[model samples]
Target: MQDADKNGNTNQTDGPEHSALLGRMLKGEKLALAKLVTSVENDAPFVPEIMEEIYPKTGRCYSFGVTGPPGAGKSTLVDKLIARLRAQDKMVGVIAVDPSSPFSGGAVLGDRIRMQRHALDEGVFIRSLGTRGTGGGLSRATGEVLRLFDAFGMDVVIIETVGVGQTELDIVDIADTTLVVLVPESGDTVQTMKAGLMEIADVFIVNKADREGADKMVSDLKGMVELNDCRETDWKVPVLLSQANQDQGVDEIYKELNNHREFLDTHTTEGERKAKIRRRHFLEILGHRFVKKVEMLAREDERFRDYLEEVQQDDANPYEITKTFFQDEEFARKIFGATQTKPS
Candidate 1:
């Protein structure tokens, strides 16, 4: 497979198939969308080109992130939220991040099973993504997948993380609003929250409110929110309770989600906050592409392979070798120049 470069040269990384798939996806073909998502998840060679073509269609969908500790009823809460969104005649896309299967490196929890009711709904799209050993409770492909959903004409996209405690703050970077779901047993988590979950929550939910100590958890979170003066914005973080199993108090949570979204629309539209988000996203893309380029080089370039061999055999100091490689003008040319000439 190959595509033409800007300078009339052929690059062996992309072909017509992906472009045809993208065309089908944009025309509302669900199968095409699914195939494109699989390609993104697997880090296909054509991802950069695909994203470049679809970038103009993104930013139309508002994204929400739902994350918390395992067994906190996060899945049920998301299910309920999806229904509410559907009731308003909105097209929804869900990216449920599940723990990876050790053998296949695929999503094992199968969130689609729990969301079976919406399986046949044309307005709803649900996908389960494996964390693939990436930290921050999300697959490395999550950001790109969300963009694909946006370009597919979804009104809203929800990202549900793998429920890893504390370290799941990456959602704040990608989601327009972040919902931190907790149970009454999570009192200890709140008490020791430090700078992690507590800082990232745009809305706090104490799910399974029928359980004991639920009220106290709500009060404690509210008190924490009051004492936390570090927020730069005027939007007050709301703490709500829900028994998602019985469908109680979900409306309040939904209402607050909209309220927060509205706040962001009005306040962060064109400020340093928005600029910071764009900058972070750019840096993340740059870092990911640079890593992929290096990986390809290590596989094909004999000199780079020798460097890896020395590190593997402990015959060279990795830090010194890295500094020397950066100093070599030819090394820089190989990395950046290959972007246009080499297959990914």
Candidate 2:
């Protein structure tokens, strides 16, 4: 597999068939799009090339991230949101990040089963991405998948994280707006407070509003939003109540989503927020590339294997070995393939 260079360029050449697939995807062929998505999910050798080709078509779609603890009715809310967007004649894409199946590494809760009502909607595209043991409540391919949806001309893309609280905060880096859903149960409010969800949420929702303690949870979130001084933006986080199954308060959620979008459009035009997102993306790509290169070397290079064997046999200090490995000029050349300069 070809890797990206220091200048973020890929030398991997795609075959004629791969080029044809990209062309078909650009022409709005759903099958072609599906194939490209599978390729991205699998981290195919030509992914960097595919992303480079489609990048210019991205940054046109707005993304929303819905996340919280389990059983907060996130999937139901996403279903309603998709319907609302489709009603406005918007092309919607949904990436439902679900728990991975241990045996097959596939999404345990399939997208088709979760949002079956929209399965037939031509304007709606839904995909399920397994967490695949990724710690951030999302698949490593999620950001790339979002780009795919954006380039596919989606007006709105929604990412629903694996209902894991706290560590699920990675969504804030990707989503333009994040809605943290909670239920009326006791301790849920305290958990949110302790988990720092208040800081990441643009909007806090107490779903299943008909249940006991819903009003109090809403009020608590509102109070937390008011007291949280870390927010540098003028947009006050709204805490709304909803019974997503009944579609209650969904219109309000939709309205707030539009309001937040407008706020971003007005405030984030070439601002630090956009710059920060771009920087995060760059770092993520760089980190992934480095890890891949190390893995490749471990598999293919005898020197790297020798180091690993030494460490495995406890014949060398792993940390010292790593330090020495970094100082080796030839090893650097092999890993990065960049021209090196000698010290004066």
lDDT of 2 by residue, 1-344 (tens): 33333223343355677789989988898888888877776666677788888888888899999987666889999999988888899999888765433211234445323577887899988877764433332445788889998998999999887554444666545889999888888454456464477667888888998998899888877777878888778998898999999999999999999999999988877467767877888888788767766766776667777778878874678899899899988778776885221211
- The residue pairs in collision within model 1 are none
Off by over 4 Å in 2: 1-14, 99-113, 132-139, 186-189, 192-195, 338-344
Q: How far is candidate 1 from the true structure (C-alpha RMSD, Å)?
A: 3.9
lDDT of each residue in 311-330, candidate 1, tens digit only: 77746788988988888776
lDDT of each: 0.77, 0.76
lDDT against true structure, model 2 = 0.76
Worst lDDT 10-window in candidate 2: 100-109
